[model samples]
Target: MSEQLKQQFTKRIVELQKRIDSIHHDFANGRHADWSEQAGERENDEVLNALESEAKIEIQQLSNAILRIDNDTYGYCGTCGEAINEQRLAVQPSATKCIKCAD
Candidate 1:
């Protein structure tokens, strides 16, 4: 990877880490439980929990992407070894495939 791209990825990884930490803290404090008791609230809580779980999984993927960045493999598609497009990377820094391979 180019030094500039690596730097950008590192910066992004740091930002993601901060966000993930904040989410963890919020969840630990039961902040989302505030909505667990309104009308139709059980379903809302289920959806929110599912979304939060997905976010946590994505955060782990982002952390893995940071490792790949450090290892100089950040922009390579995991499925086919093609170079992942910069635009795609900008949209999803944790992506492991090129658009074609992803499709």
Candidate 2:
């Protein structure tokens, strides 16, 4: 992989990590509501929970991508051992498999 692409992916992963940290902080600081607001609070909490879960998964993926870069394995399909297309990497920097192997 080009140094430029690796740098971009690294920057993206760092940004994602920051976002995850913010979500964690928000979730931790969430407040309990009064009885009258409990129902709405529950619904909002559910949505926040879902968002947190998604962010956690993305953080994991980005972490793995960073590891791959460190190992000199970035941009290679994990399943097929082929060079992953630049377009695919641009769209999903954490992709482990090429489009064919992914299918």
Which structure among the candidates has the greatest lDDT?
2
Candidate 2 local distance difference test against the native: 0.81
Candidate 2 C-alpha lDDT tens digits along 3-87: 6666776687678777778777866775666776777767877887787788778878877887898899989999989999989
TM-score list, all predictions: 0.62, 0.77
Model 1 lDDT per residue over 1-103, tens place:
4566557656765676676576556456543345545445556557656766776677678668877877888889999999999999889878899999999
Q: Which pairs clash in model 1? A: none
Q: List ranges where model 2 is wrong by over 4 Å.
A: 1-10, 28-33
RMSD of each: 4.3, 2.4
